[model samples]
Target: MPKALETLVAAGLMSSLIFPVYAQVKAPILPGTGQSVQYDTEGKPLTASESSLYTGQDASFEATPLRYQDNGDGTITDLNTGLMWQKSHDTTKRNLTDSIAVVEAMTLGGHDDWRLPTIKELYSLADFDGELMKPKSGKESKPYIDTDYFDFEYDRRRPFAGAFWSSTVYIKGDVQNFTQHGGLQGGFGFNFADGHIKSYETGKFFDGTTIQKSDNMFVPGNYVRAVRNTTTLYDMDYVDNKDGTVTDQSTGLMWSKSDSGKRMNWVEALEYAETATLAGHSDWRLPNAKELQSLVDYEKVDFPAIDTTFFEVTPSQFESQQDSYYFWTNTTQGDFKHTAVYVTFAQAWSKKNSDATEYFDWHGAGAQRSDPKSGSPSDYELASEMASDYISIDNWVRLVRDAK
Candidate 1:
């Protein structure tokens, strides 16, 4: 048995027997991405044959389907995660400090226990079916979340202001030479407008051209939607099957014990997952964005921000590179079909616009970012001329399937 599992079993947290997996744990089950539709490389909707061409896309596999119940009284409950959330968030944004205070005083639905959700809990509501329409495309942009059960709005003047705050703060020292103007003492947020996760500054606001520190109560803050758990929240429950696969009892999903061990473009990674067979199971598929993000152990303050006991993370094969690599997800970026989402296990590297030689952790580890669906890693070197661009195009893969 893995040491992690042994430790859990020893603590009376989980049983040594895996027969009744769900009965032995109290962790939150991660909900699916709510992505039933599939798109091609050009951001165009695809039919069955086209979806087959990209065999391991998110729609190609089954997961815990997203289900929500609107409680008529300004609250929404996620049937999968058993989390009740605020149906509509306050239009007035607040910084991380104030956001927490506001939730403490909130009494929506006659519940005073509403609290700021962690990044994982906030992300459970993300739905990939929404599209980010091009500016002046004469089309309406859809939010990455379901608008039917919850209300969402974005500032027409500020495109990125659609981001909603989570309580999980970015670890300070994990960043290397991160020198954004006004600095980055910030918490993470999920931008439903563009369908990605990023860290936003809690202290300063970048008003188009210049960064200014916020003095007023709410100029530079992100939106917040409060959540309260129905059950005691526990850490992820991972059980080693001893058959080259690991089962996450929390999410009811099984994962490959090791990654592909090499980098590949999005299409290649998808096909690789479709054909992968391990531990006597052939139904493995590439995980969707939410499914894959569940594996990130944000509590770990180091490179490869994941639990390494049951799962094997591949180290960078390049000379003198000590960090791990990003892993691809089946979810495509809604704004650009040619780009897909990837979660960084290693430091999210960026080069200075003036000096390409100097690189630093710009987005921190475990950030959900996007890259071109198919491109040579060298093709992005010129694109890195902008300090805001991330550096990886090719990423590794880890397969997942619905647990039996």
Candidate 2:
């Protein structure tokens, strides 16, 4: 099946996966606070959602904290997400084919539990807040990863080589490299530059029966990082703090009791969250695009991608009031200054909703996408503009704080 037609189903790992799967392992922890806020066209805060700090959102810094412990015996452990990692890469620079074989055949520290990590698993190790950073010695530049946790070589020969191969051949039903901002053909990879995860192509072409490398053709390959499980990774596990907040058991992120309760522009949404003191927590902030999209449930297709039972989403009965299904994300539309990304909880992703007028690129109905940060209120023609208590708006805000 074409990758574009595929949606990530919440099922057991495919039998074809080369990595060894523990029943419920959440190995290869994700790094980065999930805040990639940048400047807008005028050099002002790009969107109200963006933070002045390079660390994106301050609350996220506490939520998805970069906590790790390096085991001298060639391994690293993430304290936030209990995932173990191989401290270094192959350094030999092999294509995707050899890379997989190298990890599978190896026995590290009298243990043979090592295997290539999935795209999601591989991403759990990135530290975006530290990208392009320089050490005290004044080196060229550094990737946004914590050198204390994982070992990565700054290959001068292959400058753009932070792209690491993931075990997932197909992601979200699209070939790893088939997304709007994707990589090669064989699988997906995590680009460490801005900490963006996209589809990466391997040099080989899968000819019905076999996977062959593009030896005749020049194949610029990515890195290989191995992962192993520490414990089970949960889904939809949340804890209501009685203080009007909900904490996710799996990701360790705490969310607001409800949304902004009204539609707002990008700036307004940011301010609303920044000033919010609900439940006695004043460190609330708008979630980035990826952070917000993480709430989606790919297994649910009828009403929306989010878990309606957990979140207060009243989709059918809002016609009489001023409300919008969209929420703003701090992610800029690629590098466009005027536009930013958003997600609609009320939309669904499917073949029937592929039409532009009916759906967005994500196929998941509104599929968190880009829209102008500031535009005419009628850009979406929302009814809120007509209400006396309403003002110009584009999206809503869903606040989150670091879970203590």
Candidate 3:
């Protein structure tokens, strides 16, 4: 048994004899390496290890046993997370404020606990399937979601109908410019068409000088998919599989225990993930931004989002603020894929995140400066640059396998 398990056992809260079917332990053993496997360049799922060499495969992550339960009454329940969701997503035109009101007042499938999902919860639904939102190029990439289970529409048809609102409002004070009607502050959301997570100016008002008030809501082309049982959303844990692999029971993703060790550019990162093998499994691929962000422990803004006890925490050579070993994510910046998105697990926006007293675990503590990943990851003392262009952050790599 791993030391993480022993610690959990010592706490006297868990027992090996009693395994809860749906209860999420911190880390669970990863599945689908030996017997169940899929290959890249090949469309069909295969049985047995696809190849012996450390060749990269296509980024395919499918839920084993199909976790969706289509409850005849316009509702779907994800068995993995035990969260019930509205089956259909309506594109009815409404502002963010109205959208929230509509969902709050709604009673779907005879259940009344439906509410807007936090950015974290909303992002959980995102799956990095290229075909789901097939675009001429990534410029027109499909939505960052799985349309098979829900009535999602992320094709290239409607340019306006791209983003979906999350309950989490963007509080970072660094955004100099974006399309916010009400005010400068943006709201957190997932862009399906381009597969990026960002804060859209949720301002419903339009004024030349500035937004009149602060009602963070999407203007138009946004919809709501109500969710229930939020209390059960995060009963998850991380497990060191002891096989150079770590499994997240809550998300059902198998990740490489160690990181890529070095910082590489975006293109290099992908190539590294493709040709890597760990713990006798050759199916490892880079994790997307949504996947990377999910591991963050919101409560621990003072330290890395993850528990260093289980995950080998890589501290930065030149300390800045709360910065863990920055890892590369498959999710890219919306303007261009040249730059990719990465999670600053060691950070929290100080002005936004109200924690004080001095702990590097919480980022956002310092002023919103140019992220170190923007060209100078190792240079801790790089003077902050306020360029208009969006520079992609340089990142290390952590690979992931799909849910089996």
Question: Which candidate number maximizes lDDT?
Answer: 1
Kindly list the per-residue Cα lDDT of model 3 for residues 172-226, writing each as its tens digit.
3323334444334445566555444455445432232333435443344366778
Give the Cα-based TM-score of candidate 1 against the true structure.
Answer: 0.82
List, residue by residue over 70-135, the lDDT tens digit for candidate 2: 655677766656767788777665667778888888686446888887654565665544344324
Q: Judging by TM-score against the true structure, name the best candidate.
A: 1
What local distance difference test score does each model get? 0.74, 0.54, 0.52
Root-mean-square deviation of candidate 1: 10.7
Model 1 segments more than 4 A misplaced: 1-29, 172-183, 204-219, 230-234, 316-324, 351-358, 377-387
TM-score of each: 0.82, 0.56, 0.56
Q: What's the residue-level lDDT of 279 in candidate 1? A: 85
When sorted by lDDT, best at the front, the candidate numbers are 1, 2, 3
The 10-residue segment of model 1 with minimum total lDDT is: 16-25
